[model samples]
Target: MKNITILLILLTLTFSNVSAQKIKDGETVSLNGLSVTFNITNKESVTVGGKNFDRYKVSANLVNNSEKSFNIRLNASPQVASNTNLVELDCINATGAKLTSKKMELKLKAHNLNATYWYYNKEGKYVSGVLPVIAGYYLDPGDSVNNNAIFIVPQGETPDVLLRKI
Candidate 1:
């Protein structure tokens, strides 16, 4: 009985550690000289236009946690090639609503890439910009996309921000 209990405890600990390594809320991944932290919140599944889809809202913060100012560009590509299934949602006010009539979709091609620029000025101040992928999609519009963003962090000495799927 004693041996069995110890074996079970060890097995549980090993499995727990391995599972923890997988991406979850508040998990940080390192890229370039920067430490990238991913915080995904409000993940839910909803249906629109007679189709069921998964939607996740995510906020990414790039920390220069290092000693120098850096320039970072955020980018993401769809996992699947189909364009009609991928959509980005826009939020109106505090509530999440599909911005209507307008069609919002992110377009990622093999040749062209989407990029957003961020400048980490002195004193650890972070400034960010958006590279709109899907033009017709809006927050308040009545549509949603089945796509997520892919972040790329370049190799360099400065801090960088990469893309992620939320």
Candidate 2:
């Protein structure tokens, strides 16, 4: 009986440690020419560029340890750009989840900008207009290092933006 109890305890501890472990959904190596440290957690149903993403959440923590401000932009394509105004989607900060249908655009008047994405255009183009606002937080300088966004996959559309962090 004593041996069984000990084995059970060890198994419980191992399982607990595994469950308690935090898995990162995504990682940002560099941002805005500054080394950034941040992490995102609890992500699901992630699809980008018409591909079903394996990872649900993106968690990133800066390794370089640089304190700097950078601009982050999220853009989508294959869906023609229109004059239609972009709408803010529902978001939660603690969970780091965002849902938006429209594409996001940014006009950078400054030189300091950091953009990260899963893939880019053939010409290595970056999106400019129709930016999506998630969780009432705009990607800009002096934002939280643990920021996250969600780009909704348009119906019958592939080649979507999966993750973008700066």
Candidate 3:
């Protein structure tokens, strides 16, 4: 009886980890019966305050893969959890030098201006607010949606985006 209980506990944990995955650029991960991915479509600029800032344009996609429909609020501000990171997504160079784990320990710092998928406008074309609004998406079975977000990094470097959660 005791051994069966322990086996069941381990199985539950393994299944949970499988669902909550770390998704990298162009990779799809399953979370709560949904297939989600973040892809950098291109790098573009948004003019703000009479100045122009370059930003990476990312497209987030979510597809309902299960037999039933569901609703999920994207964890846009995952940095607020037990661990704190400087950036929302772990943006690293394509080389992946000094990479230890799939997840990076983000240091508290700043580099340039940017935006989030939260809030924006026609002039600023900004989605940088706090989401309000990670777009508030809910879908039925077999439904899918594509959402856009932007992040700014230093010039001449491309970010290899890695998201631990949705």
Residue-level lDDT tens digits of model 2 in 1-166: 9999999999999776432111223333343343333343444455555555333332333332335433333343323323221111221222222444222222222222333445456789764444332211232343333334443333333222322231
When 2 and 3 are scored with lDDT, the better candidate is 3
Model 1: what TM-score?
Answer: 0.30
Worst 10 residues of 1 by lDDT: 152-161
The candidate with the higher lDDT, 1 or 3, is 3
Candidate 1 per-residue lDDT over residues 22-70, each given as its tens digit: 2334666543334444454544555556554444455444443445432
Stretches > 4 Å off in candidate 3: 1-22, 44-54, 71-137, 164-166
Regions of model 1 farther than 4 Å from truth: 1-24, 71-166
- Badly placed stretches (over 4 Å) of model 2 are 1-28, 31-33, 37-40, 45-144, 152-166
What are the TM-scores, per candidate, against the unseen true structure?
Answer: 0.30, 0.22, 0.40
lDDT: which candidate is best? 3
What are the lDDT figures for the candidates, one per model? 0.37, 0.35, 0.52
Better of 1 and 3 by TM-score: 3
Q: What is the lDDT for 42 in model 2?
A: 45
Model 3 global lDDT (CA atoms, 0 to 1): 0.52
